[model samples]
Target: MAYSLDGVLVFGLLFVCTCAYFRKVPRLKAWLLSGSGVWGVFYKAAVIGTRLHAAVAISCIVMAFYVLFIK
Candidate 1:
C-alpha cells in the first residue's frame, strides 16, 4: 500500500481539528463548533478535489459537534 498526498493532507487537517478540539483553543474551538467550521471543511474538500477527504472532514466536523454538544 502507498500513502497519497491527499491522504496526508486530510490526515493533517483532521489532526489539527482534533488537537484544536482537545486543547480547547478558544477561537478555533468556537469556530469548530459552529456551522462555519463545517462549511470550511467542505470548502477545503472542494479545493482538495477529493471525496475521501471530504468524508474525513465531515467526520471530523461531526466529532467536533459531538464533543461540544454531547460530550
Candidate 2:
C-alpha cells in the first residue's frame, strides 16, 4: 500500500514523539525549539488543509501526558 504524503508525515511525527517519550524528553521539543510548536509547523503545512497531522499530534500529546503521569 502506498502512503500519501499526509500519512507519511503523520506517521513520522508519531514515531518521533514516541521515541521522545521513551527518552523522557518533551513532546515536540524539536519543533518548539526550532521556533514553532507542532501546531504551528503543521499549520503552515496545512495549505493542503488535511487534519491528519493535528489529529496525530493530539494523540501523541495525550500519550506523552499519559506516559509522564501514569506510566
Model 1, 1-71: lDDT tens per residue? 02865456546666544544433456654554343545565344333434355566687686567557864
* TM-score to native of every candidate shown: 0.32, 0.32
Where model 1 places Cα greater than 4 Å from the true spot, the runs are 25-71
State the RMSD for candidate 2: 11.0
Q: How close is candidate 2 to the true structure, as a TM-score?
A: 0.32
Clashing pairs in 1: none
Clashing pairs in 2: none
- Please list the C-alpha lDDT of all candidates, in the order they appear: 0.52, 0.49
* Backbone clash numbers for all candidates listed: 0, 0
